[model samples]
Target: MQLSTAVERFLTAVQLEYGYSEHTLRAYQRDLAWFIDFAEETGARELADCDIELMRGWLWQRQQQGLAATTLARNVATLKSFGTWLERSRLVPGNPASRLRAPKAPRDLPRVLADEQMRRLLARVEGRGDAEHPESLRDHAVLELLYAAALRVSELCSLPITGLDAGARTVRVLGKGGKERVVPFGGPAARAIDTYLTVARPALIARAAQAASAASQSAASQSAGPQSARHDALFVGNRGGKLTPNAVYRLVARELEDEPGGGPRGPHTFRHTAATHLLNGGADLRVVQEMLGHSSLASTQVYTHVSTERLAQSYRQAHPRA
Candidate 1:
């Protein structure tokens, strides 16, 4: 069978049989397509004819093209998964990618905002130009939950209204790999979310209702796609649509830019800062890990370096018996 025909069968099998999401299957398909294109450019025609040297050469070419270590690692992983599928389907005698070693990626520690920076950022949110604006309220809520719950951006954006428990100061998050965990927040986050839910969310939903009414009148409406627009989405776009990851990133950046002497700010910065602050406050590693929804203690341990540096700085300034 042709390489394209076999790959199509494998992808279908993975989606139908293995129950992979469309997004995951598409990503794997893209990565494998890139590999196939590269192979064809280098005079290779079939999966069975490919060798370990060809795989290494492709990786070498990617490195030469200046791909980041993390991206290269993902590419290698995609290929490995593809190879496994191919081997299972008898398209290849063995998995070539199993023997291919991924390039060592640098363990760059996540950057965290200092306590002062966090304070300043929160201050900006509180003293907004207009409290009545729903966007302002949404921004405040987004920042509060991001810092307070130590959530990943996706988790924060994907949160349904049903997951929040303002009375209990806890939120249920659907994290990576479909793991469910309850993360608690302080009074500030709870208060911010309360304000948003009461003042802002309704206004946002009102806009969504308006859009839906308008769409109902348009001639193309009947042929239009079902409103993937979730009116119940906790954080909504200005257009009353669900907030996308890009919009979340941009929102963070705009808020940071508005702050005085703002450094880098993103959704992940809050997660890193929260973890570091928790460790600095003498919270146990396991507790911090649970708060951040980290599957491994090792993943949470990086924040210890941030706390250690802070401790060393304090010791230098305060220790008298040196």
Candidate 2:
């Protein structure tokens, strides 16, 4: 089969059968397209033409173009998974990419804020501008929930109005692979979400809905489609649609723009902080795994490395004979 045809089929199978999210499908599509482009450049268009050498060459070409090792590793994984499927479907003589490998990507431990840092940051967030501004109220809740629940930005952005269990102080997150889980937060998160829902969210929703109505009439179509005048989305954007992941990133970045913690300033920083803090507070590894919505304990175990580094740092600073 043609390499491009194989990629399309693989995308369809993964999306329809395996229920991969749009984000994941798009990532695979992008990498596979890159590989197909490289293959075509080499005049090998058939899926059957892909062998270990061809696959490794493609990876090397990407490295020459300055791709990171992690990116190369992911491309390797995608290619192997695709090759396995091609074998299962009898389109290839064997899993040609089975022997392909990538450079070992360094496991950069996630950047985490200390307990004191988080407290100070949250205090600053709470006092940012007038607390009554609709956007300010929403920002406080977003940061609070992110730290409390260890939510990926996508999961947090896609939250529906019904996802919150206010009385229980828990959130129902639709995670990767479309899996759903209920994670509890602290009283602070609960309070922030409540304030947003009761006061700020409605205002932002109405403001955006009005703008959307006008824009829809002015233009026949738009990129994000015709947004409804109302929706059940928990976090509405300034444009009145659901809160987008990009907006979340900008919000968090701006909030922490001057933070001296010296690391990533996005939503995942909060996620990392939440996980590390949980581990530091003596929470069980499996429990932290479940909280982070990590499908594997290995994924959650990286925070343990972060915890160990912090412990060693503390020891060196405090020991008399260091």
Candidate 3:
């Protein structure tokens, strides 16, 4: 079969058979579209026509066009997956992109909060400075669990009330690919959550009294209360709807924007900072890997590079080898 036909079939299979989400399907489509354009520009025809030289030329074309390393990596991944699908479906004899190398992604160190900054961030989350504001207390719990659990923003936002085991200090998070893992946090996260559930959540429920006024209007109203208020949502918004991940991210970004010497804070910053802190405090790499819900130890190993850099700084400053 022709390369274009095979690519279409592969994408169809990914959508229908593999059950990939819309976002992933769109990404695959984009990557493959870029590859097809590259192939047309390079005068390549069939699947068998793609070789190491052709692949190298394609990468060079992208480089000359000034594609970022991240985009290049995604492009390579898309081609590789397409090649694999072609081979599996008997459209090609073998995978042509099996040996193709992608551009190396630029290494940027993960952002971490200094101990004092962490203290301040947590204090803000706990509403230590603004105890009367229900929103403040709720915000504190959200941020605390995010840092303490090393949860991806989506995972944190999707967290269910049943996932929390307060006595065990553990939370069961459903991560990428629907994989479930248990993550543990410390006393601060626990306390923050407890205060939100006890004090802030009820006030949020009360503020949503307008929602109650609609009770007699429909069956949806008769079923509404704080317990069943947000349809089992753990975090309720000011309007009594589920708090979205985007909203959570923006809230964190807003809080961090004002902090002294804190660089480019976002939702992921908490997870990165949490992982770095764990390694610094002598936690095992494998333990961190499991906590992070990483499929491979290699993915979790990046923080070791950060750890080594810190050690090197200490040796330079504190050692007398000179």
The lDDT, on a scale of 0 to 1, for candidate 3 is: 0.80
Q: Candidate 2 overall Cα lDDT vs. reference?
A: 0.86
Q: What TM-score should be assigned to candidate 2?
A: 0.92
* Candidate maximizing lDDT: 2
Candidate 1: regions farther than 4 A off: 9-27, 129-131, 214-216, 220-231, 258-264, 312-322
Which tens-of-lDDT digit does each residue in 1-322 have in candidate 2? 6888988999889889887878878889999989899999999898768888888889989999998999999899889889898889888889988888778888888889889889988888877725457888888899999999999999998888799889888889999988899999998888888888888887777776666666775555554654553677788876677889999999889867767767788999999999999999999999999988889999999999999999999999999987
Could you tell which candidate, 2 or 3, scores higher by lDDT? 2
Candidate 1's residue-wise lDDT over 170-288, tens digit each? 88988865788999999988888888878887787777667667787676873462243555567777666677778879878876775554445677878888999988888999999
Q: How much does candidate 1 score in TM-score? A: 0.86
In order, how many clashes per candidate? 0, 0, 1
Candidates' RMSD to native: 3.3, 2.2, 4.7
TM-score of each: 0.86, 0.92, 0.79
Ranking according to lDDT, highest score first = 2, 3, 1
Q: CA lDDT, every prediction?
A: 0.79, 0.86, 0.80
